[model samples]
Target chain A: MNSRLKFLLLNLFLLCSLSAMAQEKINIGEKQAISSAILNEKREIWIHLPKTYNDSSISPAKYPVIYLLDGEINFEYYTGMSDFLARPPYADMPECIVVGIKNTERTRDLTPTKSQKKSPVNPNVILFGDSGESENFVRFIQEELKPFISKNYRTQDYSILVGHSFGGLFAVNVLLTHPEYFNAYVANDPSLWWDNKVLISKTKSYLEKNKTFPAHKFLYVSQANNEEQNKNWNSEMTQAIEEFKGIVEKNGSLNYKHHFFESEVHGTVSYPGNYDALKFIFKGFRTDIKKLSKNPQLLEEEYKRFSEKAGSNFTPSETYLNVVLKFMKSNDFKESEDYFINLKNSLYPKIK
Target chain B: MNSRLKFLLLNLFLLCSLSAMAQEKINIGEKQAISSAILNEKREIWIHLPKTYNDSSISPAKYPVIYLLDGEINFEYYTGMSDFLARPPYADMPECIVVGIKNTERTRDLTPTKSQKKSPVNPNVILFGDSGESENFVRFIQEELKPFISKNYRTQDYSILVGHSFGGLFAVNVLLTHPEYFNAYVANDPSLWWDNKVLISKTKSYLEKNKTFPAHKFLYVSQANNEEQNKNWNSEMTQAIEEFKGIVEKNGSLNYKHHFFESEVHGTVSYPGNYDALKFIFKGFRTDIKKLSKNPQLLEEEYKRFSEKAGSNFTPSETYLNVVLKFMKSNDFKESEDYFINLKNSLYPKIK
Candidate 1:
């Protein structure tokens, strides 16, 4: 090769290598697929394991799973939020595995009844044309998706279902149909106006028949500002949600909390609403670090109480115990340090 | 080869390929590096571009930048949060490019004064031994980092600075030292007790000399529940922050908001605090989409008012205008649709 050509090639190689080094990708999760017989198709799933899931220093741990609907839109932020909220020494909730289920036919899967409506904007046009096969969709999740997750990951018995809009309607429907599927449900700006408030009737009938929600079941519903929504369409959305709220509150047997975000519209409520829902569902999970320094046994006592209220056992993870031990050692709390060390050893035994 | 051996090899090949297909990574951002003369070292940066940054359908756009501190910890959630908030039709803020600067020497870069203190837990050991080089650090951001971002990305003139704890102290210090660097500043549970309230002194002196903050400058400070903090250490944190709040509020010239989170502690306050800070800083950004359908001119009017308050020029993006156009067309608002088509064409003209 000519000397000039060799010099140019070397320069090109250096530039390419530099650019490659600068473009390291930041990955939050990975995709997986399941051949679901019920759905008669290959369903794709996005899974985000907690940071400690692969740490070799700690014992392998089981995390509660959150099955989130509308996966493509919400997965990235939801996973990051869960990890942030579950940071140890001041964790608001236990570390969780986030499973984001993407939609193929969103309207068909999320709606509960075969009903259609004329467009709010143009009366001649129909909305939700291929609507209402939630029973089959729920079956796909409960039978196929749940089994796939459990068989693959170290998951706790506790699980939560999270959805927005029609997904929110699905979450409410699943709670009514299969309360045993998940311990908690979050509905963000749900389309309760569906089929002229069929879910409202279902909620009332369920309460009348059962007399109470299943023990330890939690439901968090967030309603967005309806003033702007009223300008767009009829006030049916607000009316339906209010009616459902009144029925639930009057029965007073369910662990329910409803928040009305005055500033948030339908599209934006899920971000803040999801944050608030985690805080509410796991209200007693955070134990004071200062108190833990003086009285280390309080850690186990607090966890026990939280577990009792949660209706599921939630032991402090090996990662959290390690943080507690480090805090104690650095602060010169000898007794507390010894207590946590013993606790860690007992919970996560080393293999001989 | 024997039939059994051939079959085994074929099975192994299928399994490997299946696993590869299933493990496709979900990426939110990418990493970049800058060999900085100001810091005298190569600094790593995490950059997240908004979804529409690379869309070919619309004209290339410029985005406001958010310089985030303690980048390694907060980068993931902060990026996702920014993208979610900037979604069209109900966007609370403009699309922003998040640049997360990972820490090399956290205490040295974030603290302002060369002062040491005894450990709150153990009086024998001192804390922050290698601290106090924030002036040089801010210089790195202004001279080195900002220039790098502006040269590489399609960045708008507007920018924001966000920090937490010691990072928060850095933000406050930079605000007092170089208010023109960022259009807005956020400090979440800032360690105002640093160096015996040195930043507090700087704030008072700055106000005394200047008599008023630069026009359109904004500052948001969030205070976590000090009740638990009091149990851990001295009440100096709450006292210093309250004193600074009083000073700023009394001056009453800067656009300022202080929130006291009753339920949040030091470790967890940044999550909610950051969300609130964004909402406060971009208070007038969200326009009623329904109203825009009736009065198309209101769109530009809203952006004009918001831009004035933000001290920067911010026109509606091509992508958002497209969303508005679609909303109008589907709603049969022919006049409004035509108006938005003209707006989009003018703002993002096509080259023949």
Candidate 2:
């Protein structure tokens, strides 16, 4: 072939290869049907796995699961976070399965109580009347979805329930009603004023009645200025929740943590909150420092072991070590310093 | 038709309508081509406009332009940052046109010189010997790209050139050779060790000869512990650059800033570095506490003006305002607190 023809053909091949590589589909979850009796509908669900899950040789190990609500909006964030966090150095957090529950009827599936409130745009079609589906939603998670996940994937008993807004309301509902359903709960600015603060009142009642419940972690967060207006729904609801949190700390059984982000709004707080929450929750679950430090070879051995077991060509990158060191420093987990130093040494011995 | 059939038809219609709405694309930018003799190639450029471009009512306003390299990796970050930084309390930075130059053969286009070393796998294929393309790259930016951008976009003469890695090398190259090309240069962890420290030696020689150059802002950043070999490269290059910076500072012609981030790695430093670089470059640009405090109405006027002119329907969301406040506090630019308060009052009158 002539030079011009060869160049054209080469360019076409390069373009095709690059496009194919760039357009590689992000692994979205498998489709599953979840039915809710309260909403009286079946919704599709998507569950994402960590990059290390394809190994068939390793024995099926149970993994922690995060149940995410508003899967459409937050699934990508969770996927990115989970993938990054599970990689070396940030491996303080274990690799877990992410179950993203897609919203079929958002208002109906997420709301905790029924209210006769028609949206302004479509007054004829009921917009905000359906509520109290959270109970059934939690049940669907505990009874239907959890069972399926346990049977299908290598899932541990430990699970985290995550939600925002109405989904946040559902997360709180699950925490109060079925504490045993999840090991941890992350509720980001939940709409607590729904049905005239019905959930808030129920929370007070639940805390009053139940004492010495199961050991678990609960994170409740709100925006900075969300508490300014007394009449405002978010304002009033957040105040009531804060008051309830105070009561729970003083005399209740559940272990609870609350963070108020002055900089973030309801919508934008999820990313930072989720990142902080995961770090906080898994602060204790890490490799022993002594084991890592005493024998520096242990760090390399562990990395190699996991790499071999997972069949991943994963060597800890410098980015990984930095993340691990930062996590260690931020958490005041000094015991892990030796492990981190050893990790750095092992990863970048040529630097010195 | 039966009730079931009618319901199904209605559902289908609604689904189609929702799909159409979701598929509606936001017109973000105009695609154009720029001719370059240095590279002997034509490069496709994506020029994004401020929302007011189509509106005839807006005046012939000139805006500062940010020339972003590795545009594909960071287009969304720039877009979001530009949109947020230009609004409300943090209006210190002017609304500018963003010119994203897409990559074509990144290694070839960005590298400074051509190397002759052969690869271990293939003797015919050279690995790191590519050098000397940097002059041509700068010429493309100086002669062709900048003029095209100025002619097309409503841009001010003041420009900021930004890049990472090899792109960063080109940015520094332009700043060194033709200091008049851009008002500010941001080199985020540039490959200063390219072609066995060719740029470093060139910079040293250039600084020794030229006592007084044009007044310009140069920001050089180095990531901590990015790679095993990069650690040495970053430190050695930084030391050499620091020596050069000391000379320039003594001469009092060039305003240079250097930041060493021991925490962040190469891949992740872009987010925080970009944030800091923008703040540093635009420090004391247009901020007046006395003026703002005296005329509270001015804040509202500015807010209204941007809101109307930008076509963004931006009314200073609580989240946006919070970001402004956070940025102001961090930067010690708290002069516009009253102005921000007034803007907040105008936006949400009922809250007060």
Candidate 3:
């Protein structure tokens, strides 16, 4: 090739390569060690901030943080879900930060009690097997991790604790013992049957002594068919919560929701339950889809509230309406259709 | 202080240091390229075979394969879902080999047409822009990739094609032009609006001239509010299909299903849609949940069918029942509850 042609081709190649590299791999970010404490040695952490997080033009923005356990498995699931949920109209949920805590010793960190027999993998190893360290794990979160996160990120006071299996057990333990730690709690098919329902029994005793759990929301969910197995332990867990709900009703301090996911199981119920939990806990603040349809002004008012509450300068757009409608329909919330139409009318009143 | 003690302590320190070094970081696998003659390039591919896949005792079993596009992003998503789905009753969706085609040039490979406007990003200056390289892409799968995959792995003829967005568009293109490429095609929020509805228009033309497509299943889905912005165009696309549906009904040679995701978006709709599509498409082949509840024999019959079809001697366990029930409830297919129960009963008649 000619010298000029070769030079042009080289420049073009460099530009294309740069552009391809710049397209941004959809990575949330790298995993990093958040704490150096000896107990925190095996624990790694990952955080996902939204794409709009760095935009200074979008000011005064703060996000709710979701602290998830079993980060190695669920970090990506929540990250992907949060990314899509924060996109448009059902923009009811803000683009929050997701903090995933990787487990070092799942049994030690997640379980409240040191049950020697429960752990079948190792019978001889004392410290490595059935060694309870949940109290220390919670301390790590409350003292070290939370403080570091609050200092580093633009965050709202609102926080959520999510867990599955043993993680679910940990979430419940935290919610019961340190209720002030999180605004919302989701226990996805928790092992309430742990240690012959030690947690459940302790929960019953805790409710007797404690009059209230503040203004926090607790969602206890179980999959449908697990009722027939293990002597219907899931139903019993729900019943225990129902008893706790009675105590909360008498005290009028805690708002508790019990959902029996008759279709879900221990492992696969997290996805739908998590989505529903977010919707349920925020139901009080949800935009009135019905009222909005009758009046375009209502939709605008709701958007204003969303922006104000989320502490972001988010405007309701066409894309937003599409997203809201989609989420509503998928969750079988069809009653909100007219509200979505009203939202569309209000947002793009000039289009027609 | 003794010389012998000092030597032993030094050796212990060295061993501890080596162990720490090994445990410090995770071993992320190295990237590799897969050669394909049809594309005439070594495409980057990601392969994840399950832990059970390597077991020689389970040899001579041909596993089903799932081919995913936008592998870099959606590969993990499907991997997680498949991991969860294959566990229990939902185990109807067998454990399969996952092949993720990592994108080197997404726009070039994914887009069906080579438009001048969108072609500027092409580095090769091959004028593949708007040139319709989908045929070549399909040929690469048929001629090169498939042969390589079949040669390397014990793969059954049953294969599934999963794609999202532009990848989804490509999936639909392959399904229409080359129906025999895969047994099932999952097009999640395909960009039917691409090139001003070029694919949909082409589909209309193809259907008009065609006598019938092969015996295959096609799943066309759109996120809930996706229709709100370009209602006219979206409706036009739907109308085109409806027109084709009329034609298909008269001839009765093809099987197609259209799902309107009123609650999902282009980005977030894939999870629910993919789950539902798999459930719906494979509904009849598996034991009817309701039937299984009433008759233990039905569950065994369904298992036999599943085993025969999959070419694997897999049986549904209690864990599988829990997972399937969880999935059905999460998707709000409560009506299928009876069928699931029946299937469970058939699988484990003694339990019920």
Candidate 4:
């Protein structure tokens, strides 16, 4: 065939080869509505686990949990982030179970106190309808939800509470009122403007009294650019946030972090904010294999430091050690060889 | 009750309230194996779609797709990022269908050419067993997978090819060999050092000929800090990447972007790399309601620019329109009233 004819024929073949069809559904996490005696309602929740969650051969261990409020809306995003961070390469976050609590009453459950100001959108209607149920909501999680999780899920003592907007307010409320419940709290763009900044003022007094915590706590607060949208209105909001930050900063017991994202609006802040929150909480999570391989002494120190922060003791799991070993063996590092030998001996002291 | 007794009683009540149960499984996306004629084998695939993918009620439209290489390992991470980016609050990314191509032969499929060097980790073992099959693999995707996906899924013309490490190398190869395949290509820490940087040298020649593309393609290249471990080894990788960047920079046909993640090593680059890639490709994705409300004209111009770039003559979809209208109605923007009417009129045309 001629070159032009050959080109035309190839194009015809390509077009004939490819055609379109119907699409299949991509399923995500499972949802369940567990009856909550405390809230006197059936609370819906979405649960997502790591691939190795049930693989006994891969990971035979308990994992930490991240309990996200507004499960129906926010569960996928948070759980997805956790699932991503937990895996190889990044390994910035450990594999864990995610429990997303779907809201029964958005205003009622998430809000700490009833608002005197009318709804921002509606003039006559209260901002929070049948509100200030957060105390009960926290109780439900503490008494009903948590116990159920412990029994059902492979949960460790370490727990994280993640919330946004009204949910963020609830998270902070839990942190102040019942700090013992979770090891870490992530509050993104919290509605501190609720009831004329009462929550912010309340935080200072709470901080004064609560100087000691049963366990160390990581509190991440992310501020959105609400000021740009509603400048005069958001003055109160900004003030409340600043005051809360000041109080938290002064409070030595709390491992507090505040990030102000001018570029990200109220809604958009959650993605990067939540990501940073997790990264902050799990600081030093990604093992420095190059550093460790160079100086074996650093591994123990690194692990020790991570244990103190991660809540879980820093002993490398068998699977984790194997991954490290593979990398080390690939390069042939002497210090790591000795380190792995010691680890193997300690784990299998019964042998030989 | 006495203060001490009251505290004790409260603690006891809290402790008694919560208890444990049997763990439930966390449901994620399903997996399947499709027979490929090109490879003469059934290739495993994992598919995850956006929430609105099936729910026509909320979003009566098709979505763009992300075709991920090394699907079994990287699917969760990529899908997770997309899921996070798609939803409210962080609606930074549009809803996307994720089609993860699970590897039957990682080295064989990913590498375009055979390596002279043996496996760095296992010297006796060849680096790539039955390698140099990327051309066949691409054909499998073009003739088999693409057609299968088109037949099965509600996919838009806007497709993204996401790959990491050796998979990343495959992505760029596809871009060079068949630029008609995808709208965007994300190559994260591409193993450009493959077969002594022959791929990098090949790119210049391909760029020299391919001055025009079927669709304006977005090509995002990310570099990991390989220098953190082996300076000399990383030097070659960096050189190949730099050469590719230099060539692409000179070539105007490719919408090029390069990001160097100093902190993230070879393995961890995929997380932030993929995230940034999506963000870069979908530049100005988040419709600035604040800007739109002020000057409704900007919305048209903004979307027009995007439409031109995205290969979709992107009229704001009905679902996107509704989201904007809801926010506008909530705030009661006067300028937005006309915009809403225009949108509603254009979409419904028959509404009373």
- Against the native complex, each candidate's DockQ, computed on alpha carbons, is 0.44, 0.05, 0.07, 0.16
Candidate 4 CAPRI level: incorrect
Q: Write model 4 residue lDDT over B32-95, tens digit each, in one string.
A: 6789878999997888867767664543577788898878667765776687677642367678
Interface RMSD of each: 8.5, 15.3, 16.6, 22.2
lDDT of candidate 2 over B7-36, digit per residue (tens):
655655565564454333233455566777
Model 4, span A1-352: residue lDDT tens = 5565556555544433431111232434666778987878898788776666767554366788889887766666577668767765347877778888887688888888866566555566554557877899999988988888889888778899999888888898888888888989999988887877777777767755666544568899999887454544466677778888887787656778899987677777777788889889988877766666777667567778889865667566555666667777777776687787677557534333
- Each candidate structure's TM-score, on Cα atoms with residue i matched to residue i, is 0.94, 0.53, 0.61, 0.84
lDDT of 1 by residue, B118-215 (tens): 88778899988999999999999999999999999999999999999998899999999999999999999899999989999999899889999899
Sort order, TM-score high to low: 1, 4, 3, 2
Error of 4 at B117 (Å): 2.8
Model 2 Cα displacement at B43 (Å)?
A: 12
Estimate, for each residue in A1-352, the C-alpha lDDT of model 1 and write its tens digit.
Answer: 5565556556555655644653487888889989989888888899999999999998889999999999999998999999999998789999999999999999999999999988766889988899989999999999999989999999999999999989989999999989999999999988998997999989988987999999999999999986655544437888888888998899887789999999887899999999999999999998877789989999999999999999999998899898898899988899999999999999998999
Q: Give the per-residue lDDT digits (tens) of candidate 3, residues A1-352.
A: 5565555556555655644543332345456677548374745787777656776543445677889888776766567666555554334366778888888778888888877542122334333365568888888888888887889888878788888877788888888788778877877777765666677667767767875555435555444345344433455655554454455456555555556666555556777677666656555343534344335356567667655543344455455466556655544455566567666666556432
Report lDDT (Cα) of residue A83, candidate 2: 59
**Evaluated with DockQ, which candidate comes out highest?**
1
Check candidate 1 and list the clashing pairs.
none
* Best model number under lDDT: 1
Pick the winner on DockQ between candidates 2 and 3. 3
Instruction: Return the candidate ranking by DockQ, descending.
Output: 1, 4, 3, 2
Question: Comparing candidate 1 with candidate 2, which one achieves the higher DockQ?
Answer: 1
